[model samples]
Target: MLRITDARTGDPVTATPARRGLTRVEARVERPDATGLRVLLTADVLVRALEIGGTPVWTVLTGTEDRAELRARARALGIRPFEDERDGGPGPGLGEAQVLRVCARTDEPAGGLCVEVAPADIENGVALDDGSATALRLALLARPRGTELRLDAADLADAEKQLKHWRGAVAGWATRPSGPIPDPVRDQLRAAWEDDLDVPAVLGVLRKVETSGTVPDGARFETYAYADRLLGLELTRDIGRGTPA
Candidate 1:
């Protein structure tokens, strides 16, 4: 089960509004038997943890941050001065220093994650070639407090595939419903769908029965009262629970 947060208030939200813009959303995913699993969708990072034996693997791709940022990143990964350096020995410049590059291990078989780099910064001691320097920030964001941090590389081709499938499914929903839908009641249900308050299976039923390129403005409001009421009740209950819907 999961609860999505309202981007502004941090309160739980059920659906993505078609009109009202969300500042952001973080998915609080919980499995009854699994603990410490979290999914965050933000302006910068959109990563999902895929695990086998409780080991999380994430694929990342972005082209931001500067050379200074990369150097800072190197330091964060435990890169240190050479042991042979004397008290005042000359410090190695960017060209010679090594930065710990990280890659999530899950996506390797799926054609790999294509992470971009600031190609111009390569000469500035920033190891933009591997692009793993940003992993620590993303990992820490998703890691639960008190958990030991462990990083690895993985494949992420599945991410694009999954997104494509979702888009395709949504596109199919653009067609109108077979029959008529009274305006007021459909307005209510559409609101519910926009709010993610209605049970998905029920919406599927409406879509099949209405067949008229969506809901009609007004036909039989009385006929849909029961369905409308049920969805409203469900929405109310979800709001009260403030956890899962």
Candidate 2:
């Protein structure tokens, strides 16, 4: 079972009814090796209240050391890191850093994505129904590509459909939920659903592309490369194929 805890207090903060505050959600998945499992966690702002004045909080992210550790961990599990494509074309920018941040904190299984939302990302005092919607959407646009794995075509298609459906459902629930949705997460999700260009469609096509056998097993890095190409194509189409600033 996945457990969430307050990173600072180490107390039970996740299960509590949604309250306006800074919190982290910790995900613990069973390890694949059976010898032991790997764990991963990320920090996100749980927008509990919209009307309160609070201190500015910052998320601490490490580089160099954690990156090396996570790379080794993924290798041990027979999973490869996404290839570094910044030298030429665009790739999952900052995604590696985010992944490393999450993996360094826990030992969990593979196949899940985690995101962090900081307090600075949240804009208080704005009505949720107003233009804050677009602000939130742009926030997701700014987020780096999450995972770059070679997925089975069928699996990719299924994940795409599931993501689309989840986006719609979550958007509707955001307006009024019998329960509560963290404000920060709610905004980011809604934005991704509304403005993210062709994420699902790109994944769907990638499924078919991978099955052509051009990318071999044990070559997961190539999967990232392919995903980047698909993303570039989609973005190009979105911006008339011109250079993306």
Candidate 3:
């Protein structure tokens, strides 16, 4: 019942298109019994390894004991065993394709867990550093609200469109009267114009101009002008507010 996600996209499985016609993927142990779990490549365990882009990439292994027993053995060996129910994956420099990895507590009695590290690639694509990618993917999933803001190709395009429209709206306001502007309108324009600016700064300005509890119609031009000057964007059609000297 333990759930795990990649540190980058906050998903259990993340695919990377590092090579054409081949797919790179990453997964982790939901929770380790100790601090780090050893990976195994058993027949049953790897059957569920999903394929992406027609390439089945995974290796499988088996462990000697259940989570608890493995942890004890790991501790006795001086290497901190993986934590229980904690997510883990291999480190970087490990190839990504055609390798099945299972995180389990080890029970090797000879003072060492039987280490099985086999690296391979799918479709001739280069392998990834399994350990680094897993750690990064896990870190990404741990943050709040971080999952919502991932910028993909479509998102970037959408933002670009919005920016264009916002710029046009500001241009329209710049040419017309300047009495009051709705806070929402000003906020949107400010956001669009500032592009990569922080949201708090814009919100602060909104609070300041909204003291009367009403959105000033002319605030559109005023706010646009203010933001343009503050953020250094071209307020091309500034009519009411004189161009900054």
Candidate 4:
């Protein structure tokens, strides 16, 4: 039931695994630039979502980019390591798995669905490596995949603030007995991520849940914990810190 907008057809397509029990995904990350990082992040998100839904994923990262730096940054961003990491030019021999060409729009499509990501326009004083890596991730996820990411100091600051608030809130809620996630909220969260990985929409659901008076605190905690499985935001990190003051 996982649907993603195919860059080739420009339409939503069901991502069916070629193999019965496993899905093979290849992501071409050409450079260690901003767009390249975005590509890596996007591919990671897709792979994680598939795995979360009970599909074993075999991920391959192939490109001429500096593998060391790329792997380092991916780890910093909380992206898991790919199963097959190789360095080569285009046309690496691939299996029947779905292919994702993560590159700029101007780059030639490497024979799969092209995920076009524009380079981030960071402000003069803003350094991507400076502050909270999790916040940087949130800022990136806030935008649609194909849109230009105009990251600035304000965006990073806001993302950091929101991340802190959510962690604190989750911690406070965790003090109460755990409760089941409401069916409607759970459905909404699943629908958002399943629909072409609409992470922004998923985040919107979290925002609403945060302020909803009807959802008991325990349920709120469970809701966030459920969403974090796909979000990878570490939303429950503060659970043992005893709620923030």
- TM-scores, all candidates, are 0.19, 0.22, 0.25, 0.89
lDDT of 2 by residue, 73-94 (tens): 4343333233321231111233
Regions more than 4 Å wrong, model 1: 1-22, 28-185, 194-196, 201-245
Worst 10 residues of 2 by lDDT: 44-53
Candidate 4, poorest ten consecutive residues by summed lDDT: 88-97
Candidate 3 per-residue lDDT over residues 66-106, each given as its tens digit: 55654443333222222232233443224543222332222
The runs of at least 3 residues in candidate 3 whose Cα sits more than 4 Å from the true structure, single-residue gaps closed, are 1-149, 180-217, 230-245
- Residue 126 lDDT (model 4): 77
- Compare candidates 1 and 2 on TM-score and give the better one: 2
Instruction: Identify the candidate with maximal TM-score.
Output: 4
For every candidate, C-alpha RMSD to the true structure in Å: 20.8, 19.6, 21.4, 2.7
Model 4 Cα RMSD, Å?
Answer: 2.7
In model 2, what are the clashing residue pairs, if there are any? 19-48, 20-48, 20-49, 31-37, 38-107, 38-108, 39-106, 39-107, 39-108
- Candidate 1 C-alpha error for residue 95, in Å: 39
Per-candidate Cα lDDT values, in order, are: 0.27, 0.28, 0.33, 0.78
- Candidate 2 Cα misplacement greater than 4 A, ranges: 1-41, 45-55, 63-155, 166-245
Candidate 4 Cα errors over 4 Å, as ranges: 17-20, 83-97
